[model samples]
Target: MSMMKTILAAVAGAATALALAAAPAQAAPTAPHVRGTSTVPAYSYENAIRESVWVQTTLDGDLDGVPDKVAVDLVRPRETAAAHQRVPVVMEASPYYACCGRGNEGELKEYDANGTIAKEPLFYDNYFVPRGYAFVAVDLPGTNRSTGCEDVGGRNEVLGAKAVVDWLNGRARATYADGSAAVATRWTNGKVGMIGKSWDGSIANGVAATGVEGLETIVPIAGISSWYDYTRFNGVIRSPGYATFLSEYVSSRPEACTANLAELATGSGDDTGDLNAFWAERNYRPKASRVKASVFVVHGVNDTNVTTSQFAHWWSALRTPKKIWLAQQGHVDPFDFRRAAWVETLHRWFDFYLQGLRNGIDRAPQASVETAPGTWVDQRTWPAAGTRPVRVGLGNGDGVTGTLGGSSGNAKRTWTDNPDLFEAEATATPNTPVPGRVAFLSAPLRRDLRLSGIPTATLKVKVDRPTTELTARLVDYGTAARVNYQGPEEGITTLGTESCWGSSTAADDACYLDTAEDVVTDDHAVLTRGWQDAAHHVSLRFRTPLTPGRWYTIDVPLQATDQIVRTGHVLGLILQQSDNEYSTPSTMGATLSLDLAGSSLTLPVASGSLPPAGATAPQVKTAPAPATSSLRRPDLRQLP
Candidate 1:
C-alpha cells in the first residue's frame, strides 16, 4: 500500500507539470451547442440529422386567462429524402421557467469561485443526432425569451411540447447537413422521442403524460419521480440542491442568458409563483392508463442529488414497455464519454421503439452497467420470476436478521443518529465517508447468490424525535471486501413539514437563489418541475442489486455522516442519514430505530453449497441453530 501511494503521488506530480507546460497553447474552439462535438459535422442530414433554432407560441388550455410563449433548438434528419422513417428526438425542457429566455454560451465557470457559468457541461455536438435521430431543447413558458408565466408543473410546458411537435411536423427545411437543398416540412416521419439529463429529465416524464400524437419514447436520467419526497427525504426538509439550481442559480443569470429569470422573479411566492403547481400543472407518468410512450429510465446509483429510489416508482407503475438503465456514475456523468458507445445504446433503444428496428436492444436485460460484477442478466421480466417479499429484523448496533417465509419471531435493534457525520465532506473516489448507517455480516457464502433487480427493507422504526430521516442501502458482501453494486438508495421522510425554498440578496453570494427574497439553498426551497414523491411509513424497495461476497446492511437508525470514515478496507454496508458536502444539504439532530425482526436482506440463492471462508463464490451451506434472525445458509437451493 505504501509503495502504491508513493507511485501515485509521483504520477500526479508529473501530470501536473505536463499540464502547466501545455497551458499557454490555445486550443481550437469547439462548436457552441449542447452536446457539441468536434469530430463530426454539426448537422448531418445524410445520416439523418440537422440542427436549427425554432420558435412557437403557447396556448391557454386551462383558460388561465393569460397566454404564453415558447422557443426551441430543433435538430433532426432531412425530411424529403427519408419518408416513413421514424426517429427518436431528445429534448431538454429548461430547468427554470425563466431558463429559455436567454441562452447560455456553454461557459465553463470556476469550480468554487473562479467564475464559470454553472451550465450543464456539453459532452459532444449533436453526437446523438448523427447517430441517426432528432433532438430538441426548448425554453419553458415565460422563460428565456419565451412567453407565459412560469407555469411550472402545470399543463403549459406539456402543451408547449405539443406545439413544438406540430411546428416540426408542418415545417419545410431549406437544406440538409450535406449542404443539399430540401424542404423543411418534408422531414416528418411522424415519431418523436424525448431524453434529457437532470431537470430536463423531469420534464421528459412530465410531457410524456400529455400523450402527444408523435411521442414514442422517453429517457429520464437522475431526475426525481416525486416532488414531495424529492425535496424532503425521511420527513426532513433537505437542501434543495436541484431547486437551488433553477430558482436561485439560474434566476441570478443575465436576462439575455435565460429570459424567464425576470418573470420568475416577478411572480408572487404564495400562489402566483410558477415554480409551484399553482401556475403550471405537475407532470407525472400517466396513471398507468394515459401513458403512450415507451419509457427507458436511467439514474446514477450513487447520485447524491437525486436518490436512486426516484426512478423505482415510475419503473413499477409505467404502462408502456419500459427498460431502466442504472449507471454507477453521477448525474449526467454518462455523457462524459465522447465516443458513441454509451450514446449508441441510447439510440438503439429509441430505434427499436420508434422505428420498429428489429435490433437486440429490446431484448437486452432490464438493467445493465459496464463496470458491475458480472455480464448482464437477461430475464423474461424484472423483480425476477416467482420471488416473494422477505422481511428482516435489524439488531442493535449493526446486527441484522429476519425471516422470508418461515415463522421467525419478532426482534428489535437500537441506534444513535450521530449528527457529526454531517460535517465530513465527500469526494467522488474509491475511499470516502459511508455515513450514519450500520453494518451486519453473514458468514461466508456457500453458493453463488445471483440477486438481480431490486431489494428493499420494511422496518417499524422510531426516531428520537417526531421527525427523522432514514436511508436504506443494500450491498452484496464480495470477496476481498468488494461490495457488489446495489441499486440507488431510498431516502424516506415526512411531508409538508419538509424544507421550502428561501433566498435573499443579502445572503451569502454562494447561496443558490430562487428569488431576491426567497432562496432555495441546500436548505429550504422546493420546485415541482414534476417527478414522483414518497410519503412516510412507506416500505420502499430499491431497484439495484447486491453481489456475492459483499455484506448487505440496512441503516434504519439512520443518522448523518458529514465527515469521511476511512476505516481499513473491508466490504461494507454503508449507511447514511444526512447528505453532507458529498450529498444534498441536510439538517442535523435525530435518533432512529429499526425493528430487526421485520427487516432482512434477500439473495437469489443458486443451487450449490457454501464455499470455504476465503473462496470468492462459496458453494456450500450448513444448517445452524436459529439463534438470531440473521442466518448463514451453507447449501444452495436446488433449481425447481
Candidate 2:
C-alpha cells in the first residue's frame, strides 16, 4: 500500500510541472514612467519597429475611380508588434515630405531599399519613440507616395489625414503595399496627438477642429487657421493664384492635378479677393466648438509668411484646455529657437495627455511669451492678465507728422498713395515730413508700455479714387537690440557644431546643427502691420467702392503683437498705401484725406498708460538702421 501511494504522488507532481511549463511567460510592463518630472526611456529606441501602410480615404481628389490612399510611415517600440503592448501616436501629415522638406535644415524624408522610412525629418520621431510613443509621419494626399491630387487645405487634404487617425482607432481601413490589410487594432490604444510646423501644422489644426474621437491633442506651430486670411487681407490679394501655386509646388505629380489646380484658381476669387464658399470650407476657426482635443499653440509674433493673425483668431475661438508659446521669431520652428526647453515642455505635455500621467503640466501657466530678444516669461493667459483696450485720438498737426494723444483735434491731413514705396521707407523719420504717407507720434512714454494684443485703426477718410489700397503700421521708435525677424534667416543662425536629441541608426542620426538667436540693434521696429482695400472697407465678402470726396469710416485690423515700448521710446502710427511687399500695387495714385477728430487707434495695452500730449519727443542718436531687405516670401519649392 505504501509503494502504490508513492508512485501516484510522483506521477501527479510530474503532471503539475508539465502544465506550468506549457503556460506563457508573464508580459513585461511596457508603460513608461515619470522620473523627476520627465518620462524615463523604458523602451529601446534603436530596436524600435518601423513599417509603412497606405490608409484609404473617401475622397477621389485625382478624379481616379478608387478612393485616395495616404502613405503612412510608422515607428514604434518593438513591444507593440505582437499585440503585447499598446501605445499612443504622435502624427505629422505633411505635403513637404518629398518636396520642400521641413525644419530649418529643410530635411526631406529618406527611405531604405525595402521602401521603409530610413530617415525621418526633424527630432519628433527620434525623441518620442523611445519614450514609449509611436511616431507616425504621413504623406498628404498627392504628395510623396500617397495616391491623389493635392488640394491645399480642402476636404481631400483634411479628410485624407483624418483617415489615418481613424484607422488606428479601428474606424477606417488601411493596407500594406502588397495588397494585405494593415490593421492597427493590435498596436494602438486609440489615442493620438497631431503636431507639425507650417503647412503640416495647418493640417493638424484642421484635423483637431473635426473633433475626431481618437485624437487627444494637437501642437500647431505657426499654422494657418483660415486659408482666406492666409492669402488675402481684408479683400486684398497678397499673392494671385496662391492656392493653385502652392498646390502645384507640393504635388509630386503636378500634371495629374490639373483639374484640381484650375478649380483652386477659379474658387480663390483672386479677381475680387472676396470671401466665398471656397474659403469658408477651408476655414477652421468657425469649427472650434467641435474640437475635443487639448491645444498647444505656438507662433512667431513677427511671422510674415503665415502672419500672427492665424494664431490670434484660432486661440480666441478654442474652448478646450489650451496653452500657447509666443516666440520672437519669424516663420521658424521653436525646436530650432528654443530646443532644450521645447523638447522638455513638449515631453511633459505628451506624457500628461497621451500617457495619462499626472505630471501637473495641465495646472501650470498657460502662456510663454518672449518679451524681449531671447527672453521668455510665463503668464496665466495670453494677451496678458490685465489687458484693456485704450483709444488714442489721431491729432492733425503738420500734414507730415501728426499728434497722437488722449483728446481729439479737429484738423485734416492729406497724403497721396505711392504704389512703389516700401514700408521701411514710408515709416522712416516719424517726427519729420515724408511724402506719400502721414505719421502720428505719441508723446515719449513715461513708463514701459506693453501692447499685448491686436490693434485696430479706425479712420474717417475721403479718397480721390473709387478704390485704393491702405496700409497701417504700428512702429516702436527706440534704439535697442531686437530679434532680427526680417533677416533672411528669420532670427536664427545655424552653427557648425551638432547636438543629438535621442538614439540614432546608421541611416538616420538623432543630431542637428546648433543655432543662436540673430539679434540686430536698430533705431525702430515695426511691431504690427495691417492691409486693406478702401473699396472693401464695408465687408470682406462684398466691395462697395468708395465715393470720391465722401467721408467713410473704415477699421483696419492690425496683426497681433506682444511688445514692450520701453520708457523714453516714442510710439508712432504710420498710414500709407499699397505695401508692394504684402499686396499687389493698386498704382491708382489716389489721395486720402483724413478727419483727425474722427480717427483713432485702439490698442490692447497690458501695462502703463499713454503719456499726455506736448511731451517733447527726445532725439536719440540713431545707429545705422539694420539693413532693410525686400520681404521675400519663402519659396515652397526650395525652402532652404
Candidate 3:
C-alpha cells in the first residue's frame, strides 16, 4: 500500500501550528466547562453547518495496494470552525450509510442536487450540534462514500474507524478526491466520543477497544461485542448466513465487495458453528480491557437480535469508567421509550466526559434500569454489586408442574428437541405440557424476588444421539401488566406530527416524528432466554459428541435480566430443544433425560428474608405452550 509519509506539519491545524512555532512546549490546557449545563437553553442549533471529510486509513481494505477512505459527515457550531471556541466531538460510524436507513422510520442521509448531504437520521446532529458539541457521522469502510471492502467487525473495521480518532488527534492524514491534502480538524479540541445503535454502535465498541488516543468515551446502544456470539450460541448456529445477509443489506454494489463478503461466509464455520481464529480476531472483549475511553452502554434486556448477554458480558469486562441503561424493550432504542430523559442523561454524559465538565454525571447513578412497564429505578451499580446467585434445584412434581427445591432427590423427565415450538405455547397453559417440550414450574413466592444477573441452567442429562441443542428460558408465568418490548420498535407506534428537541432549520430540521406510548398490556412476558448445543458443552470451539447412555452435566447461561417477579407470580424455567425465533430445528431428534438431582437453575435472585426452614421453593402446574403467542412478538431481525 502507498504510504503518504508527509510531515506532521500539515496535519496540525494553522492555529495549533502557529502556537507550536511561536512558543516552547507547554502543558496542555486543563479540562474546561465549555457549556454551563447540558440544557438546550445553553446553546442554539441554527448556527451549525453540515459538512464532510474523507479520512485516510492504514489498511488496504479493497486489496488494491492503497489505503481506504472513510467518509466523515460533520455538524458543528459555525463559530467552532471559525476558531471562536473549541468543542469536543461526538461521532457515530455506521455500515448502513444509505441502505435500509437508521432508526424506526428508516431515515437515510439525504443529499442535495450538488452532492452535499442535507439531512441525517435521528437527532444527534440536529440536537447536539448546537449544544457546543460537534456531531460526526462516518460511513464505515466499503459502505457509502468510503472506499474499500466491508470486513464486518474484523481488524479492518477497527483500524478504519480508529483512523478517524487518530486524525482528529493529529496522528493521521486525510485527502480530498483530487489528491490534495484536506484541512486538518484543528479548530476544535481533539476529544472524541462515539455512539450508535446496532452495527453503528458495534463500531463504537470496536474502536474503543483499540485504546486509540483522542477517543474519550463511547455510548454503544444495543451493540454487538462479539461477531461469533451474534450468529452462534455455544457452537450451534443460531442464525446461518447472518454475516452474508447483513453484508447484502448494508451494501448496494455487492460486486465491489465480493471478495470481502466471500471471506465472511467462508470464515463463519456454518457447518460446525465452531469458534475459530477468525472469530477470535473479531472478539472485542480482549481488546476492551485495554481501552483508554470510558463507556456508556444502553441495551434492551429482551433483545434477541443482539441479545442481552452481548451487553452484559462486554460491560463486565470493561475496567474503564462506565455507565449503563438496561431497558425492558427488545432491540429497541431508549429515545422512543424515555425521550426527554434520555436526551438529558446523554447530554449530561457528553458534557462531563467529552467536554470535561463537572456536570455531576459521574456522581449520578451508574444505572437507570426499567424493571417493568413505566417502572424504573436508579442504582449505584448494575446488578447492584452484591447480587447473590442461588441454585434452586428441580423438585418432585408431575413432569408438568414446577417444583423447585434446594435438593430434590434424583428424578427423570424427558423431551425431544422441538424447534418449532412457540414461546407463547410453552407458557400458555398452567397444567399441561406441549409436544416436544417439558415445563418446570416454581410455586408462587411469599415475598417478591428480583433477578439481577445472568441465570445459568445446570442440566444433567443423557442424549440418545450424537449431538443436540437445548433452549432454556427464565420466564414469569403470572398475568401482569408488562411492557410489550418483545421486538423491534418496542411496541411504540410512529406518530404524525414532528417533535423538535431544539429550534428547527428549514433544510436540516431539528424535529422528528414523535413516537406513541409503549403498549403496556397484562400478559405473560419472557424475561430472558438462553441456548446451548449439547455437543459444545465443554467448549464452544470444539465439539464433544454425547455418548448414547452416558450422562453429561452442562451449564447453559441464560440471557441476563434486571427485572423483579412481583409477589404471587410464579417463575417458570421452560426447557425446549429448539427455538424458531433464532435458529432452525435439528433433525437428530434425540430425547434428553433430565436428572433432577444434578439439575438446578442458578439465579442471581435479590437478597431478602428467607421464607422459613423446611419451606421448599414450592411447585406449580404449567400451561401448555401457547399454540400461537407468536402474535405477541414481531419478526426477528426486523430493524427498528
Candidate 4:
C-alpha cells in the first residue's frame, strides 16, 4: 500500500471519534488527533466555530509610522481550543473585499456596523474549516477593513502579506482596533497553505516567493507572477489602465492612494512598455527560485484576462515540487467546471502537505490537462516532457495553404498593417481577403494532429516603418464543431439559477448564481496568439529599430497550449499588426514584405503521423469564419 494509504489506514479508527465542527450541542465525539497533532477527520466535516480579529502588519503603506492593520476572519475546529490539538491554516489574502467580489457568485465580504467582517466570500471556510483547518480571509492593506494605501503589487503589497505569515509563526505582533492585544492563532500549528484566484492568488505567489516560514504550500489560480507581462508583452503595451485602474478599484477613496497611484503611473512604463526597476520590483517570477513551499497551480488554457503565458512561463521556472491543472474554460473558477473532484483533490493535498497525513498526493500525477470541456487526463509532467519541433512552411503563391517541406522560394506577400483592424477581423476566413492581414492554411490534415507546448514563427521579413506592432495567431480551421475558445467572450453563457456548496449560515453562505457553459458552433478556433514590438526583436530591454526596407529575421513565440486537431482539419497561421483587445491600436500603418524561402512556423507536435508519399489527403470542409459573430472585441478593452 502507498504511504497515504498506510497513514490513513493507521488512523481510520480515530476518524470515527472526531466530532463535526458545526454539529449541534448533543454531539459527543472529540476532535481527531494523530502523532500528537490535529488532523481532519476523513468521514466527518465542519468542527469549527467562526471568529474575527484585526492583525497588524509591519508595513505602514500610508507612511503613517504606525503600521496598518489587516482584517482577518477565521473559522476553525472549536475542539482545538478545548485541548492540545492545533490545526493548520489556509489563508486567502485579497484586495477584492469591497470591489469585484470572489468566486462565481461575485460574493463580497459583508461587514458589521462596527467595521469587522461579518461574512467572507467563497466556500473555503464552509468546507475546509469543517475539515480541521483554520480558514483566514484577510482584507489586504488599503482595501476594505485594512488601513493603508493600495500599492498595486508594489513593495508594500508583498510586504503586507509577508507580515501575516510572520504573525502566524509568532514572529510578528497583531492587535485590535482598541489598541488591545488580539486573539492569537493559538489553535494553529503555524503551518499554512495559501490559496486564491486572480489578484488574491497573486498575493499567494508573492508571499510564497519570499520563502517565508509557516507557508507550507500555495495554490495560485489564474494569477499574475510578473506585473510587466500582465500589462505588456515583449515591450508592446498589451493592456492599458492596469496599474492606475486596479489601484483605484481596490481603494475605498481615490485620495487614499493618490500619491501611490501617481507613482504607479510614472513607473509602469505604459508609454514605452520597457523593463525598469519599477516592473522588477513587482516581479514574482524572478523570485520563483527563492520559493520554498510546494506549489499547486491551476489555470485555464483559454484565459485572456491574465493570459496563459503568465502561468506557462512561471510553471517552467519553478524548481520546487509543483503540480498544475490546465482547464478548458476562459478566465473562470475551476470549481464551476469540476467542483466535487477539485474539492476532494484539494482536501487530500492539504491534508498530506500541511497536516502531514501522507495521503500519497506527492505520488499522484504532476499535471492534469484538459482534452475538452468535460474531459481531462493526467500527465507525467507539465507541457508533456519532450516533443519534436516540426517546421511547417507557408506555401502557395498566396501563402494560404499551410504545408510542411514545401519551400516556395522568394514567395512574398504584402499587407498594409492597419491599426484599426481587430484580430477577429483579420482571421475571419481561411481565404480571407482582409486588407490588413496575411493568412496561411495547411493542406487538409491526413491524420489527427496533437499540438502541445509553445509554437514559434521565424519570419524573414521587412517593414516600411522603423517600428511596428506584430501579432501571430495559430488557429485551427475546419468544419468540425469544437469548443468556442475564441476571444473576447470565450463562449461563456450566464445563467439565472444558482447553486450552493457546503452548508449555509445566517451570516455566511456558499450559495452562488450559476452560469451555463458556453458551447457554440465554431468553424475555426484561435489556438494560440502572440504579440511583439518590432523594435524589441533583438532584446526586450534594448530597442533596435529596423531600417526601412531591411530584411530582419525575427522569431515570435506563440502562446503555449495543448490542442488536438482531428483528422481533416486544417491548421492556419494569421499574421496581423494589431488587436484591439490585446493591445491599444497603433495610430499609423506599415507594409510587411514577407520572404517565405527562409520563413516557417515551428510547432511542437506531441502526436500525429505524416501521410504516405503521394497519398491524396482528404478534403476539409470550409466555412466562413466568424468575425463579428465570434471573435469580436471585448468591452474590457475599453477600460472605463
Overlapping backbone residue pairs in candidate 3 total 13
Per-model TM-score versus the true fold? 0.57, 0.92, 0.90, 0.88
Model 1 lDDT tens row, 451-551: 33344444455455433445544333222211112112122111232211111112112111111111111210000011111123332221122232222
Q: After superposition, how far is residue 343 of candidate 2 from its true place, in Å?
A: 0.2
CA lDDT, candidate 4, residue 483: 50
Say which prediction, candidate 1 or candidate 2, comes out ahead on TM-score.
2
Q: What do the candidate models score in CA lDDT, each in turn?
A: 0.42, 0.86, 0.77, 0.75
Candidate 2: residue 351 lDDT (0-100): 91
Better of 2 and 3 by TM-score: 2
Q: Which of candidates 3 and 4 is the stronger one according to lDDT?
A: 3
Best by TM-score: 2
Evaluate residue 34 in candidate 1 and report its C-alpha lDDT on the 0 to 100 scale.
16
Residue 446, model 3: lDDT of: 75
Query: Model 1 misses residue 581 by how many Å?
Result: 6.2
Q: What is the TM-score (0 to 1) of candidate 2?
A: 0.92
TM-score: model 3 vs. ground truth: 0.90
